[model samples]
Target: MNFDEQTVLVTGAGRGLGTSIARAFAHQGARVVVNYRASAVSAEQLAAEIGGLAVQADITVAEEMDALFTAAEQHFGTTVTTVVNNALADFSFNGDARSKADSISWEQFDAQFQGTVRGALTTTQRALPGMRTAGFGRIINVGTNLFQNPVVPYHDYTASKAALLSLTRTLAADLGVDGITVNMVSGGLLRTTDASAATPEAVFDLIAASTPLQRVVTPAEFADALLFFASPWSRSVTGQNLVVDGGLVKD
Candidate 1:
């Protein structure tokens, strides 16, 4: 919980889960970099409130990520040692509108992968030099529980997150020698994130009723699991997927 010397960068931190994660890191005394692809206003406002830097960078684009880091280091007076890959593709959580496996296009799947897997890879790669030089780093990827349960069968979204989990483990193995720990935090349908806003109230109620906790997880609740990864307490933990869906997946 003490992140005094860490410089944290959170992607898509303009709103929702990303916003919550960034806030948590800032509150814990980490010099936070709020990276936003859009939502400039919200991102800037949050940065001002938390005393962090707001930078615009599309994680999918390498050049933009470079600029983001350069700007962050210049502004924060240090390189980023902690990264939270929480950016998500622009997709509404309307189960009724989601495409079936047979009807889903490869392009749709690719887009999700670009946001979840590729974006994480790009950010991780960019942060490596800084982390390597500092001899410490924390890479926490935000993921979904759909891959384990697949209750809604969001083929494209679920497939992309599965790929992300694979990357998380490999990166953990590769970076362990460099004092960097890579891990994932997976959550089920959150109570009310921008992505989940389109989900029906009845659907949310049904999901809550099915879970042992009788409630959907909150962004803040899932974000705390992410903090465990970045904190010194999890010094020996890596390459693991921690599900934060109120025991819905049991992983």
Candidate 2:
């Protein structure tokens, strides 16, 4: 996990899981670009603390994504060796039961899909060339294990993550020849994050008791799977989804 001189660009790095991932890369000695759509203050604070650069960009916008990469090259004087797509629309953080397939509106589904799939697609498209030139790259998409076993009805979110896994596999097939590997790490419900704050304590307790680890995974624990995909150890692996749900979704 030592990335002494590598440069990594992480989206949605202002807080939560993104922030933790950024810190992990920095801890491994990689120069990191912390990208955020808003929350300039927190993003900047994280960048300063990690000795990284904070670049503001809306992942759904191609121009802004281009600017983020340009700034990364300008600051680090090298192409980014790793790109982690962790950004998504600022939707309801709570995993409240949403629309059912029969009742869900197209707009709701589209809004989530655009952020998860389209945003990741565009960002990777922009970064692939640089990755090709460098002859190495790691592209890890943050996914959720909820899609595999949907205990809660998060129609839009679950659909988008499933789509993301498809994108990951396809991209890996298209880019593996160039040394750019695409992969995904899907995790079960996490505690304390805004996304999980609304989950009922009783439900959390039930799942934890049933799960092999007997607890929800933390952001740090989830990030460890991401790090494995980015590390040299996974060089031969690509287009695969690794479940980090403490055996909750064991295949």
Candidate 3:
């Protein structure tokens, strides 16, 4: 779990919170692999800045996921030891524009499911052989606190993340013998990520007031939890969901 010796792959790391998570891993001396489905310019820029590799792959596609790991391993001369499932489907956290319960379509839920659950599944499966061979791996899934708080009831997003949490646990049980750990880091609405940029100022103020920290969590702050799950500090922890919402959701 020494990040200095780890090659970390972060899905959807071209922008937003994923970018912060990628930077955090690189800062800790991990050989970071910035995986992007789009936003190539930003991804490449980030990779250059951090001295990491930027690989483009749609996490939901098995072929792409396979290529992603292959490219990373070939570039770094090592397999990825840490995998961060941080990519989200195209979504805007605009409560006003969201589909209501009565009007919500199954397609909406399915889209999120493909992005959150399926994406993680593909990436994990692709990364397994390397992890098994090395006998050390970290699968850190990105999740949401809405499952516990449901403040805005983002039905599709919350539900998909809920499914991801389930996957996180089951994978932990199945992979522990191989020396791999799976965990989740869930966060409330972040201050100003691209997805959260659509959130009204008033809503952000309200959420900040509700938290014990009296401020919305930043992407960088939420990213710190990802490090713990991937580091030696969390060696004994697996299949656990750590909520980092500035105390917005006590659970």
Candidate 4:
């Protein structure tokens, strides 16, 4: 896929999946804005490696989010056509799975949702104006396949992803007329730098065994699905969730 001169903003690109996604776009010739909250060093290194711009901002805060877009416009000339909402707070790998729903506090759930869903909401809203002005936009939200099969019962994380899927479909309907397409790419049990560290080897083996492809998906693999949605080939597609879980949740 030749992005050529297109600009894509990837949030949380300091490391792991977000980094991979940013690099993928950069490799395809799209000017990428690598967004990070605290991992400035890593973000800068990646930006240098890919010849992209690194912007720092906490998406949960409105002011910081505004700064993020401002920097992107300054670097890319005010016409960002793609956004990949890959930023999420430190919710996964918290090791806080209690059997009973009563054990899950409201604060825990809210924090999880606020980081993932709320952050995506704010980032997308901030980018909508530029996207509308450009008359072409692709909004890809990174989600988890845990919603299909909650083996470990991460209530807060799972619930937030479900909400994100719903948000994707709704946004696709609302934004289609504006030449903006909203979609999601859901992955299962990806072994990464920080997110899925707590997952045990046996659990991974079992999931891989169950999957038709007999393997867990990687960040790069999932990024391919995200690229498809962002490319012109998917211009007619929107409001869809493409699961890249090796056939683990094919229902």
Best candidate, lDDT? 3
Residue pairs in clash, model 4: none
The digit string of per-residue lDDT tens for model 2 on 1-251 reads 24875788899999878988899888888899999987799999999999999999999899998999999999999998899999877665454565667888989989999999999998998998898898898999999887889877788888999999999999999998999899999988876565577677887787788788899888888877788888888989999999987788876
- Total backbone collisions, model 2: 0
Give me the displacement of residue 37 in model 4, in angstroms. 0.7
User: What local lDDT does model 2 show for residue 97?
Assistant: 60
Alpha-carbon TM-score of each model against the true structure: 0.98, 0.96, 0.99, 0.95
**Least accurate stretch of 10 residues (summed lDDT) in model 4?**
91-100
lDDT of 1 by residue, 1-251 (tens): 25989999999999999999998988898999999988999999999999999999989999999999999999988989999999998888899999987799999999999999899999999999999999999999988899999889999999999999999999999999999999999999998899999999999999899889999999999888898999989999999999999888875
* Candidate 2 C-alpha error for residue 181, in Å: 0.5
Worst 10 residues of 3 by lDDT: 64-73
Candidate 3 per-residue lDDT over residues 12-68, each given as its tens digit = 999999999999999999999999987999999999999999999999889988888
Candidate number of the best TM-score: 3
Off by over 4 Å in 1: none
| Residue 116 CA displacement from its true place in model 3, Å | 0.3
Among residues 3 or more apart in sequence or in different chains, the pairs in candidate 1 whose N, CA or C atoms overlap within 3 Å are none
lDDT by residue for model 4 over 102-218, one digit each (tens)?
Answer: 677888789889988889999999889988988888999998888888867888888998999999999999999999999999988886647777666787788889989888888
